[model samples]
Target: MRFRPSPATVAVASLLCLLVGLVYLAMQIRTVFSDQLKQEYAGLVLETVERAESARDQVRVWQQLPVDHPADASGYRTARAELARRLASLDALMNASPSAVPQVMSSALSADANLTDTDNLLSNASSYWRAQRDANSADVRVRTIHIARTLIALAALLFCMLVTAVGMYAKRNRLLAGQSFEFERASLHDPMTGLPNRRKLLAALEEAAATPAHQASIQKIAVLYIDLDGFKQVNDSLGHRAGDEFLIAVSVRFRESVRKADVVARIGGDEFAVLIRTFSTEEELADIARRLIACVANTDAQMGIGHVRASIGIASFPDLVDDYRRLVAAADDAMYHVKRSGKNGYAFVTAAGRSAVS
Candidate 1:
């Protein structure tokens, strides 16, 4: 028989591959952003250099005119001031940048003693500014090249992750379709209650969120955040083994309480989430909420678990919020609101406001 990796192994391997891909993508994004900033800075530096060159040309024109002429003297003074301003701006930019070219240019500028000596001063300053511009251009080009290469690598990594994830998903489906249904169930479902785990829940949520057409047809979607009341105390007092049994029992009740189309996921140790795809009347939703609470509250005494109930918060999409993340957050907030007031109840949050589900 051909050796096949277990579903658990495949899931873990896929997760690791995706994690690595995401990390590389994040690093590349940072590099690209950094390069863009450097390019903008280089452009500013070049602009300053152009201004300096223009000032030098003006100074040359002023120098050709007679110094005795009133207009000529005024023009020379204006050109000198403009040149000084441009030089100052260039120096500031160079100081801010990590380029050695700025220091070399500054030294060249300092060597020219006579500010009014147009020919020599203009020649030296032009050479230095040109050199600085060339250096900045070179640096920008190198950074652009690096960004391009990083982007290519990021694209490749993303492709690899996509392929790996798809393969894992197909393998999981195959396992589910085969005689190893129990093993596949163990891989995707929580071992305690056999309910779908957090990973499966998130995957389902993401899929629902990504399909706009499906969402539009559904009319509205709701995520109910559920927390077991007094679960921690039970785990503390009854011992962890008993707590586990209680959880498994509670999970069964939770599953039975919901509609066949609805999905109940155990997202955390004592937390659950219900993804309600079909939107009915508020009265119907409240009925389901009551059923879940009653189921948990009426646990059999033989289980040795004290009175444990559920605090449920319902947040609907396009009704409570459009964004999936905020919708979940709203549900969570409402759940906590119930918990704070007193546990063993449910609350509903809509775009209008939050209200207790009596």
Candidate 2:
């Protein structure tokens, strides 16, 4: 049977895929920018070379004039001065981009002692610059091809992510009407992982809230909202069967991590919630969160895939919120905060404020 992935898997995968695409896009942009700068520098050097060639021609023209001509001496001096300035600019360009232009040509041009013929020096310099420019153009073309391939890959990943999200959303919608509003004593559990469902979790929360403070045996009730990280990638790379197996394996770890009195439920796709009915100290809750994270983190070896992490949000009764009903939402929001700041960590929603765990 072809296994269908859950909406939570698609959603997390889409988000992470988008992030990867953005990073690749940014790197390509930087490469293109650097290439553009190189092209600009090459153009500047060539332009300087052209101007120097023009000045050399001017000097030659003045040299051919009659020695006794009225403006011959003055014109020749002016042309030579212009040629000297252009040569200096060309030398600077050559120094800046020594790798682009041939060193032999630059050295001969600078000395002007070896190449006595002005025309020969300018012709050789022009040829060398054009060759260098062509090479640079070829390199740019190759890089452009690589960038195009990357963009295409990015587009494909995004399109798949979107389709998966839509399909999962529709599947989620189909099951919405079947959800029971009031939690019944009859065993309401998740079929796939054999854990308690969202309805059962809510029922437990309602029961905890309904209990009178005077008769309450437990001092505090805390909810740990957990969302698995990197599960989407694992699902995509491995088959859906592997994904299901992975979830099952993780659920087992979660079940083992909590106390018999505590409730662990598969509330939604790729999301789990733990109802800690009682805890002696805040550290106890923190320890539970740590153990949960470690459980997921260790899945990499068992699943033979890359690392998988968890982000947890903790909301305690009378400590974070006065009402136990708001515990789930508050805890879910706190878990999202962990996702935003950075995944693979847990955070708490307390009366003082939200504080993240390392």
lDDT at 94, model 1: 71
Give one digit per residue, the lDDT tens place, for model 2 in 237-274. Answer: 88778888989999999999999988999987899999
Q: Which ranges of candidate 1 are over 4 A from the true structure?
A: 1-187, 209-218, 300-304, 352-357
lDDT per residue, candidate 1, 92-129, as tens digits? 77777864542424433432325544335445545765
Cα displacement (angstroms), candidate 2, residue 355, comes to: 4.2
**Cα lDDT computed for each candidate against the true fold:** 0.73, 0.80
Model 2: CA > 4 A from native: 1-187, 212-219, 352-355
